[model samples]
Target: MSEKWDKESILSLSGAFQTCRILLTAAELDLFTILSDGPKSVEDIARDKSWDERGLRIVMDALAATGFLQKSAEGSYSADETMLKLMAKNGSQSILPLVLHRNRMWESWSKLTEIVKTGSNPNPLGMASRTSEEVQDFIDAMHVVGSVMANRIVESLDLAPFKRMLDVGGASGTYIMAFLRKAPHMKATLFDFPRVVEMGRNRLTQHGFIDRVEIVAGDYTKDELPSGHDLVLLSAIIHSNSRDVNRMLYGKIFRSLDPGGTVLIRDYVLDESRTNPPDGAIFAVNMLCATSAGDSYTLKEIREDLETSGFVSVNLIRNGANMDQLISAEKPR
Candidate 1:
């Protein structure tokens, strides 16, 4: 390697959680939203939020140090440009929900040691059980993340020949909306859990797509996907399953598609080294802490699994930042 070795980098990694917790705490407190309009003194903010003034000051200073907030000469804090754009509640490109979702992950991550030792998630809820409010938050977080990449992924595809599309485990119909917006002639189906399907209904209706899309409620792992579609999208779903589980789901996807239909997978398609994207390798650890059999997979492994499930002519359509790559395969005619 050409670069010099740095012990400081490794040292910094150990304390990274401190920064994450600080940021999560701020987001949970809706600090960015509170500061969106203008700066506020610690006294003013603490009084409004009913937080201890000393603790609020420490967090605000830490946030300012992290460049998330701007500290005025008068001892007031305001949302910085980045925070205003991505953390404020009504920001144009807000990802506040995603941040909140990370906050939820904290509980699972705290049990990493036990999870690794036992090779299972310690949470009895099994990643699916959540209160109605949490379910809504998770779906909204997915929407926030999907909105950022959906258009780009849709643009990368050639959907001119396909008439109908199915998005399995599609949260809030974000990708379906993207695909439909790109190809107005295409009718689509959004399949997900019942609560997520309900959320999708509201969102699709808000986007004026409820009439064009069929919203179905079912678990992809346990239920047969809706059939008759020429295109199927398994976006951000497979990494949460083992190889056997993925193959089973792929078989289901195969049966759901018409002859010559295509199945597109949007996920972290790792290279042979499994570290080319770097993020994929790191996310594998997240899976370990959160799911029993989930992991990042190499392209070779994915191809083998797809082929075993009756798909052919598999191809990588796009490579993306942070595990958003697209891989496509076709069912034999």
Candidate 2:
């Protein structure tokens, strides 16, 4: 046997899976937060958290060996500096919920073989056999995912001239809150299903943006969309459904906007050739497993959709994180 193992060696797949599960389980258990204050021995840490000492010790040692923690000479363990950033509840830093949500996503992905064989979404849509709460939970999960980028999106957008921005399908008001923090002069109407609106309202209230954010409760597809906003922000939403619905939504956005208004969309966009962007390629399969018609679209595909819906000029900006692209279209005056 070779003393040094190849990083890309096929034999390491099993170890990689175990490593990911341990990291995810630690994040889900708030272990990072618990360790943020100071270092602790395995027994004390386990006793404090009511965890199994032996199991926690094994996990901690594995993480330390993997460089996520440091084992001291005194036999206590401390979180690595990079891992501490993920423990923050506020600021632009929370990765705990995002990591936990992904762990849940892994369950659906484990049945990918079944999904491919049947060509059916492993995740149930709100339509059949699923309760309203189940649907809301799915939406809330997306909300958590979206929150990760809310801070960046809010700061990046030029909201100086815009008075009221409408966040279509904006779950939990995370985007609006981030924007409100920057553009305090602007108010936002968060439009979504009634259940989502309730969740957003609760979040807005908690974030102290209740006065600046208005909740508009209704189905955006069937009902009349809230009108007269200078800007419409649809982050991580357009790629969630069929091409037809995406085009239809763009048309509605154009109509809902005042003349020369802007519509901003952020999501994983495939390259113009419909290749190269590996994240978009993988995200396409995730949509296959999750939604009835959702798949990540290419930049060319999205630009065409915007033009067909009446936007004269469309611009695409590729942000380096997670292969996400932000496209902006302006309603012709």
What lDDT score belongs to each candidate, Candidate 1 first?
Answer: 0.89, 0.78
Q: 160-191, model 1: which lDDT tens digit per residue?
A: 99999999988899999999999989999999
Q: List the residue pairs that clash in candidate 2.
A: none
Tens-place lDDT per residue, model 2, 1-333, is 124656667678656798898888787677778788889899898887788998999998998888888999998988866788864333146566567657766776787888889988756443234466555555556666666567766667677888989999887887888888889899999998876788889888987999988899887678767898989988878767789999889888888999988998888877666554777777878777667788888778888999999997788854644745688889989
- Where does model 1 exceed 4 Å of error? 1-5, 72-74, 80-82, 124-127
What is the Cα root-mean-square deviation between model 2 and the actual structure?
A: 5.1
How many residue-pair clashes does candidate 1 contain? 0
Clashing pairs in 1: none
